[model samples]
Target: MTKLPSVSVVILNWNGLNYLQQFLPSVFASTYPNLRIIVGDNASTDSSVEFIRANYPQIEVITNDNNYGFAGGYNKVLDQIDSDYFILLNSDVEVQPQWIQPVIDLMESDAQIATAQPKILSYKEKDKFEHAGAAGGFLDMFGYPFCRGRIFDSVESDNGQYDDVKEIFWASGAALFIKRDKWIEVGGLDADFFAHMEEIDLCWRLKNNGYKVIYCPDSVVYHVGGGTLDSENPFKTYLNFRNNLFLIQKNLSFFHASIIIFIRLWLDLVSLLKFLYDGRPKHARAINKAHTAFLKAIFKTGKKASKISTARFNGTALVNKSIVWQYFVQKKKTFNSL
Candidate 1:
């Protein structure tokens, strides 16, 4: 009999004991033969580590000294574990027993397939796709991240439309499966990103290195969106707006990134105004804070950008047009429509 590849499903936790208690059982029930379940606790003041250690004695717990956020927390924990593959799962996700094998099989089939994600459905509304990553993640020419079953605020219900395995620009972080070597090659997730868009940045960098990101529909997971931060939180807005610029800056050429950022600023301004008009001034101010932070960190981010490979982004998943226009103006809400 052949030995199965060892896989580690590492969940980064920061004061999410409730999520851990609610979701860990489904993960423990994963039927993958060679699997290790680990909870990388980000110095949670809550009893998350204690709960895992007491209840799931077989599970491994690696506690960080301080909360390093998602990117840094995962990097710290993953560096300690040796495995053929790593699944960076969110704490709030519920998995099927067979979710692990299909993704591992897909990644193992292709040497170039660096990372992949399962079909993510909303835990609240099981019929609909989740916002973080619906089927597979894609990026517009301007660097806006969307998924097959989700575009902006609009999410689509699953109806076998995106069940086929396909290459994508980015895989959702909620249930991201990545090869161990590929994860290390890209230097893991950018810790500077802190959290939001970090997965997309990682995927973009992998694509830049001529690796393929895939979506395997055979593996599916339910994600309770906004587990760590609510969608309406201003800080979430800040991270999404700011880290998006960081993503473009680190992955694309200086000239191209500048052009895209220039256009994005105008588009963001419109969003800010819309927030103000809608009586959400906090969100409007959050965008302002994001741009300000991005500008301040330009020199630091540019240094990272300088290391990018000369290879241009030629991924099949990269849409050459603005998704904002497609969704809002053209009213192309569904991925098939777009």
Candidate 2:
């Protein structure tokens, strides 16, 4: 019998001992043949590494000297591992038993298909899609990221609405499945992003290089969203806003990026004001700080931008309309309506 390609499900952990205790068994339950489960610990002071070593003796543990955050941690750990495919999983996710093979089969069928993500549902709600990566990720004309099962803050119920296999602008970092070669070819996730939208930036680079990012509904995982950083945290807000600008800057042509970033600045100001109106001054200040950081980092990020081939935003899954206008002005709540 021909051996199936090897797959490594590398969970990047940082002070997520509870998550590991909760979800590792579910991940171990995956039925894929020729699989290896690894915990890439990012300098956790919480005895997470010790717990994994003691409890999950079969699982490989790689330790980083310092907390390199998500992007850098994965890059560091992945460098030492060899596999046909790599599933960069979050510690908080619970995988279905048969989650692995379907996606590997889908990816193996095509060389150009570089990255894919499983259908992500909320672990808390069960029936509803998760916020980070609902079904598949898509981008609007203004560079706003959304998902088939989620638009902005509105997450949809999983009624098999997005069961079809489709191309997407980005795959969620929460449970990102990537071809090992493609990952290395694109230089992995940008460490500069630190966290948030780093996967989107990587996906955009893949798209720019003439590769496909796909959503395979056959495999599913339930994500306990915001395990590392809560959604309401101002730091999460800063990363989202700042990294979004970094995403556009590094991917699009200067002319196109200029137009979109110009518009986004105004939209972000409105968001800042809304946060203040809602008595969330910290979040409002996060937006301000994010913009400030973007300005400061432009030159450094610009160097990275030059490395990528600037393709016009004509990818298959890129929506030509602004999701903000579609969701708010037209009151389109669902992905289908848009």
Q: Write the per-residue lDDT of candidate 1 for residues 1-338, one digit (tens) a residue.
A: 87999999999999999999999999999999999999999999999989999999999999899999999999999999999999999999999999999888888899989999999999999999999999999999999999999999999999999999999999988999999999989899999899999999999999999889999999889999898899889999999999999998998888999999999999999999999999999999999999999999999999999998947554779999889989888999999997
The 10-residue segment with the lowest total lDDT in model 1: 307-316
Clashes of each: 0, 0
Candidate 1 has an lDDT of 0.93
| lDDT, residue 291, model 1 | 98
Q: How close is candidate 2 to the true structure, as a TM-score?
A: 0.98
Q: After superposition, how far is residue 49 of candidate 1 from its true place, in Å?
A: 1.0
- For residue 181, give model 2's deviation from the true position in Å: 0.5
What lDDT score is found at residue 189 in candidate 2? 91
